[model samples]
Target: MTFTGVVPKRRLGPGGPEVPVFALGSWNTWDRMAPPERRALMGRAVEVGAAFFDVAYYNMGPHAEASRTDLLFGETLRELGLARTDYQLCGKLWLWEYPEAGFAEQMRVSLDRIGAGRGGPESFETVVVGDFMGEIDIAQVVRDVQAEIDRGSFASWGVNNWPAEALQLALDTAAAERLTPPSFAQLKYGLVRRSMAEGEFYGGWCADGTLALQASDSFEGGILVGKLAPARKIGADVGGIRERIVAAYPEVERVATDFGATPAQLGLAFCLANPATANVLFGASRVAQLDDNLGAIGVLERVGPDAIRAATAGLWLDRDVRADGVWAP
Candidate 1:
């Protein structure tokens, strides 16, 4: 259970830093727990070498709430005496707020919220532009991010849920302007969600070293955990994507049994198996869930390339053609 194994170190992108393959997903989970339990979970995560984490301001919930997630994370680190150098932290701009405040302000707010010097620096190893949903001026954003990089605020930057065309334009502009382009992309990818993996965006990243593809929602928001059957039996409203995922569960279960893993683990392995995927991000509400999912790192090599593909292919046949094409819920 020592994460010191080679599993922890992964090249984030072509010339990006060697970050851990799995960074703890800190959405609302951090603030939901009691302070004592929160400290315990952080200790366990560090023990297992899951020192890397990702959090954002807007994702910390309403401004009126208790301590925001960023502040809570920082407090826990200080309480546990974990130095900023002990972990690598990533902060992202929420999809809705990125455009409103622009790059610099968005990043400044996130860092301020996370408090100071809790993750090796008061800054991020990289910060993500949460989503590209507007008439974006890609060149301008890149310059703003480069300014942060120059000031040593963040080492690199990337996009999330951005369209293929927009990503390309940004890259092309960076090349012409001789600025650093995005080093990675964060998007939804899983057994039941294949839009990012099947489309031109993923294909292009796979073909080049300029950007690495990192998967989020690799379980389709827990539908691939294979527990929906009970929920359905109890008349739970498991419709839409949940319905599709439940329908696909049997296939996933069958494959998982072959490898002695749960459907969730198999799903995670399936994502990590993809050539374009440099990293996979997943949620863990408790310490045990964190242990189970981090265990997917081991499952990666045991499952191998061919078995992982055969197990996951054809499950979500229409995933790439979905109307939005970017699966985020």
Candidate 2:
């Protein structure tokens, strides 16, 4: 995780940009910090090479509501006099309302808010198109994303929580058209979840070096860290295994103690252990929490990926998120 202080960096894939293994999410950030604390978060992130951020508009998906997290993030960057190069942003587009919302409209909305604070980049470094709804036109989605990339909106793009077939079709379409393919796939991967990313579909692509894996929801929206009944909205229970996930937390705690680490560290380390994971996406509202999450890097080093995987194998929640074809397909 570190030679000294810097977090490690790896390519998103062969064609994508290199980024740090720890990317922060923008879910609960709007209320967490005052001005100085936010400034300190940015500074410490840069200091530890965790400047990559996943800031998405919550205009769609479960518990959909308006959020100004991205605006505040951009404003903080401007306040600190940080250049665009000082940090990386992974913008997101939603498939929850595809074709109608489209990629262009969403990008326009996201950039306007993020840039409204000034001194922020006009575009994201990379983007993740996520939240699979019913089946949609894969060609149109890929084309729209590629068009955005061509327009310098973002350098590379990835699919989030998409069906394996959709990922395949997107790649095939990109290859056939000679357009840029999605360089990565962000999936729900961690100690409690393994099927999507580690299953045959994505693992093969990662093994062939065709796509990188961005691990998300590894903490199950802080539930893995003993926030058993968090007041804030966590991601929808895509697996329909909330009870199982909650029950497994005890094992997580036990395993983390055995490994001489916090439950948060063990959960994160489990995600990092996977060879395909380009980075682990997490949310840390406070700088102290961010620093605490960083300890997973050390835990990974101490425990080794294999031992960690084996120890937590019983906690794995393997479910095809796209099975029902109602919410996702």
Candidate 3:
């Protein structure tokens, strides 16, 4: 009931300028539905103050054969009467799908789906391209991105899930080639997941002027939502990764109790607490879920430093040693 005016905004990079704090991510919503449903969700997101949409070409599916999440995302935006300039668009090019092209074709298809053409303001304000498995040809990828920028395809470029060393390599390579460097790094960061933000997994980018967009900040399939109680086996639909998370963080139950808030809200608020995080991305299966998550924005505004520290101290990992054991360190 607090109804905070709106979430704050911050620049994507040192010079890229500002965007809303709580961007609505469309990772799952797009691939699973038709264009009309996607458009309706986007409209509702805009109405509730989430003006940024995070998307990606690979979000379509493993191979081009499985889905078309990205295409549907672009179609939704166009149908909703939302101009390219009206919202901050962030898309990703998964190079693994076509390492031969080195992410160029991925970017083109992404732009085309988003309606960014030769004469228009680039549909995607920023494009993130990188590997999920931690191996990348940073130099080649950087060069490919610069070519796109030169051709007016992208306003800016970024890296996703890349470690700090690789990020620095990309930046250095771009500087050497007189090309643009990445302005953002999208990684998984949240109250429950601190490896990236704390520089344990990937060195922190915020200190060097690169913005951090925290995804899976809700820990995928709503594990942080407190839906699975009393240590039961997680549903198959929740996916193997999420089941492992629930099995790992058995202590999450205690943390949820201490916060006097839902696990979902606490997880999101944790990500927002970090000044380094430019925005937190979350998805919803329905409008009701979206509204519930948006309420966390107000919860975030009211939370103080002490609360954040307490939440951090109370992480479920501390109580459940098996948590880290489940995943590769």
Best by lDDT: 2
Q: What is the TM-score of each candidate against the true structure?
A: 0.86, 0.93, 0.80
Among residues 3 or more apart in sequence or in different chains, the pairs in candidate 1 whose N, CA or C atoms overlap within 3 Å are 84-120, 85-120
Clashes of 2: 0
Worst 10 residues of 3 by lDDT: 320-329
Model 1 Cα lDDT, one tens digit per residue, 1-329: 52345345677776577776777777666866899888877887777666778877654212224437777877787788777677787778554544566667767767776666434246788877756555667777778778888877888877876767777787888889988888888767678767655566666675576678777867655667855543221211212456666788778888888888877678778877877777888766677777777767778777787878876777864453542324333
Q: Can you rank all candidates by lDDT, best first?
A: 2, 1, 3
Better of 1 and 3 by lDDT: 1
TM-score of 1: 0.86
Candidate 2 residue-wise lDDT at 320 = 47
> Model 2: residues >4 Å from true position, as ranges?
1-4, 61-63, 319-329
Cα distance off (Å), candidate 2, residue 285: 0.8
Tell me the tens digit of each residue's lDDT in model 2 across 153-240.
8999988877778878889999999888989988777887777676677878877889898998888888899988878777767768
lDDT of each: 0.70, 0.82, 0.61
Return the top candidate by TM-score. Answer: 2
Name the lDDT of candidate 3.
0.61
